[model samples]
Target: MGEAIHNVIIGNGSAGNGAAITLRERDPDCRITIITMGSLPFYNRYDLPRVFRGCYDWREILVHPLSYYDDHSITLRRNSRVTDVDARSRTITFAHNEVMHYDRLLVCAGGQGYLPEELSDYRGLMSGFGSFEAAMTTYKALPAGGTLVMLGGDMIGLDLARTLIDTGYRVVLLTNEYTFWPHRIAEDERDGFIQALGHMGIEVVDGVHPVAVEEGEAGKPARRVIFDDGGDVQGDVVMPSYGLVPTAEFMLGSGVDIERGLLVDPMLHTTDKNIWAAGDVCQIWSAEDNAYRFYYGWNNVRLMGEMAARNVTGANEAFEGLEDERLRIDKKGHIASPFWEH
Candidate 1:
């Protein structure tokens, strides 16, 4: 017998976990390792907002416990951020300058919250809902009935806004070009969403562009979003939710084709034969549209991981995206999307 193949997956989100489990099931004896920047195991990112509801217990959101990976003989390298990828040498470089080699590699690092250029300098003042730690920080910062100003509301932040409002927190939504991102809508749809947000008891402020952010006055803890038109919105905490940008910075200079995201074929195979990519970190080539497109949503991302794992394990499976993730606004101005659901 020859040496068993080593498979390395970068990410611990739905896509990475899904791929890890599938790879083990398909190729029993193959060496499997998952590298994640986060310390905890796979957790439902959608449920991260539950922290604001006073559920700081991470166990409630975790998909599987630590023993699950151990029982399956899968290595979980937590807090390991990949800094570089050498496609030719088949090595992954970590931030600590440690390097490791893999026979097969899959990139599913996912995306990060996009902060607008205007508010870039004030990133330290704002809280985020992207990760467990960020959510907890935001939760701790707020007092009873504390106001939260969403600089730009994306679907994720909007979902969190609803929870914040119901939990006795004031939410001011400042709409911008990136609102309801990953899903582009018509003017009517946008109007419908704005109306719906108003009915949901959120203060929807539109037509203003944010230019900068400022800390609150002495003896008063708050964040102020300064607008281009000399207007501003003040709140206890300001969270920027412009949207997400692919977390593919490490893939740059790695000899893989990248455009907004790592470009991959229907098989999830990158330009390099030894590597594959999935989830929000990749833009799949859509032959029908003759362009590379990104598919979002929980189910879609998980399926992408599974398909990529299969292909990595010697199965030539082509990924047909799982969800029709288009945003829909009804006559009643109710917004509907799989992302808003479990």
Candidate 2:
């Protein structure tokens, strides 16, 4: 897989975008193609909350404009979702019915929200941070002074919750765990964040689950949410986060050991030598625990992008799972691993 002629990257999310930049920098003469599911103009999900909360403008929300990439001779296929992937012939068929051959494929198809069959009745209620469309849909439907309940109160939940609250929507987040901020903030610290946001008028309800969503009469707020704890709460909207699948369904039978995610060696190369996955798509081997780990954070995508580039360009840079110390930044400047602690 040395200097593949036609390299097409799937998914234009942060991981995919970073991979493109990384690849171009390593091998300038390489012919790179990017296939994205969303429309033109890629944005950072990390900025969604800030933007919705009146923190940043649309210009600030955009990570890279089409013109910037155009100046670099990078071709973008916006709104072109790949319908099929033929690993045997190394070809991908887009929804527009165009076939493109790839010498080597780099998968940065970041995680997508999970829509379980159990909740098939309310599957339409699920959403993720994969694209700007999701952000907009959530933003437009979120009503001012109305209650929003997050089904999964992880990183995405906390972020989106902030956005809804800041935009004048009353938010109540429900999490299995008592605290939010999966290891970035401690119990006390997380509580403090929650309290501060609560001061901003957001509520965190933990240790419970939503039994069902009682929608409004055809054109109303969610109306009511039945909880397993013999209690109920009314909501204007309910959004579920995807901490499950990383939009890696295309690689289903592509010889990739996708237990929790596409498993990769220390070099960030997937089980298939001809294909490589980065960011939320690839499950990196954790040196700390000797188990496969999937990191869906921002910095993790950046690190994996460069490493995947080095590996794809015939360079032999070993892939190291994210440096936990750097990822574990506490607001109070403590060295504790708040991202994981209960």
Tens digits of per-residue lDDT, candidate 1, 1-342, equal: 998899999998989999999999999999999999998888999888888776889988999976999999999999999999999999999998899999999999999998867568888888888889889988989888999999778888888888898888999999977778878787766787788878878899999888888999876657788888898888899999988889999999999999989999999999999999999999999988798988887888999999999999889978887556777765656566667766
Residue lDDT tens for model 2, 1-342: 665477778877777778888788877778888778777566777666664665434566788765877765567778887777777888887778898888888888777666445555775654444456666666667666777777656666665665576567787776554234334454555555555545545576766667776676665566566777878776777776535466777677766778767888778888777788888777888787788877657777767876787788897776765555222324544223323321
Instruction: List per-prediction Cα lDDT, in the order shown.
Output: 0.88, 0.68
Q: Model 2 segments beyond 4 Å from truth?
A: 1-4, 54-60, 115-117, 125-130, 177-201, 217-221, 242-244, 324-342
Best by lDDT: 1
CA lDDT, candidate 2, residue 188: 56
Q: Which ranges of candidate 1 are over 4 A from the true structure?
A: 219-221, 330-333
Error of 1 at 102 (Å): 0.2
- Model 1 gets an lDDT of 0.88
lDDT at 69, model 2: 78
Q: For model 2, what is the error of residue 232's alpha carbon versus the real structure, in angstroms, after optimal superposition?
A: 1.3
